[model samples]
Target: MIIALTATTQLGGIAWLIGRPFRQSLLVSLASYAVLSISAIWVAPAFGRTPLSCVPEKGGAHAGIIFCVTNRHYVTPELKSALNDIVDDLNTSFPGIQLGVLDASFPFLNDFPMLPHLSHNDGRKADLAFFYKDSDGRPLPGGTLRSPIGYFAYETGRSACPATRFDLHWDLNWLQRVWSKHELDIDRTSKLIEAATANPRIRKVFLEPHLQKRLDVNHPKVRFQGCYAARHDDHIHLQL
Candidate 1:
């Protein structure tokens, strides 16, 4: 009887040992699956592979001011510095003006279909927009401003009431006038571009046609960095 009891106990212990590994394996598999599910929900959207959960909504003091779509990884150091310098000059020139940076680089694949070949592809371009305001602290009378750069589809015929047309224009006239008159702002932007070009790392500086016209061809102080690359209509694209 004692021998029989010993054999039964040994068999029971063997079965318990065998089951422990299966239980542990099941727990591990569950944990791995949970982790993968959470990652797919959050991390995948940042790379343009999935739809974004957090769509941008209007926040600031203004209601119609829509937030820009951007990913932090798309901005390079050089581009960021250039943008900051521009903002500083703008703030100094037009104090208390509400200026904001728009699309630096859209994370969505088809976000800006019209500007498919934009410099944002390589993280070297940014779209900027200014807030419209009246003499009072209220929003202007017009509808929200469309994107400064990009193609839009519109109907050619007047009968097509629902149809719209593409209109492309950059409001740089004020900026041109301001830069022309403000010596300090001009010097700042010039120096910024100079530093950008001085680096042996940079290969070219693309300027808009209007900007090229404004720059003196034989200005001894300014360097003729590079010829226009045809693609830069709204913002200058610097190549490094």
Candidate 2:
């Protein structure tokens, strides 16, 4: 339980320990985790990190509540500001756009591993979901993602990366049929990349080569993450 909790949420294992000796372990542990997670919003800033809002804000929001519940929505102040700025920019042309923030670093530790994204150990990296339009050719309300957690719903595209047994390049072919029938909103996505690349604070944006061509994203800062890392066609990775 501790291992799984720690793997999912960095602070969950410690919360488990805090509730281990109690009579109602499940309730105690859950309550403990809630307290710890909420406390992180205040405590994390001391360590130079800020927690992204779990609720849908004016400009941005966690792609799903799962990210906040798992304690995976913390980022540096500069990054948070940059994301807000990008979303604010998007709203000017595309009104009421709520940028979906996917996996981000945990609060507190530097060089502490966030599984699947080892480089996200620091608070400088975050994943943003691609904007999607409903099958009817209309933008989904508030930029809703095709997948529940803003991941694994890949757009059809070709890649140069070869098959590897040890890497994180999971196709998850079986799950593709289960997602919502939403088409990638190419205009919004292209604009998002342009805005992100234009931002001087964002040093790099990792995306697949095919997507760059498909979306007409040609900025030097927008580069491929390579075969060793997970595919970025499903989401965008921005780092300082």
| Top-lDDT structure, candidate number | 2
Task: For residues 77-181, write the lDDT of model 2, one tens digit per residue.
Answer: 999989888988888888777888889989988998888775888899999988888778988655377888788888888875887678888777789999988
User: lDDT scores for all predictions?
Assistant: 0.35, 0.86
TM-score of candidate 1 versus the correct structure, residues matched by position: 0.34
TM-scores vs. true structure, each candidate: 0.34, 0.95
Q: Which runs in model 2 stand beyond 4 Å of their true positions?
A: 61-63
Residue 198, candidate 1: C-alpha displacement in angstroms: 10
- Give a tens-digit lDDT track for model 1, residues 168-210: 2323333443221111123323433454455444555544433
Model 2 residue 203 lDDT score: 96
Alpha-carbon deviation at 197 in model 2, angstroms = 0.3
Give the 10-residue window scoring lowest on summed lDDT in candidate 1.
151-160
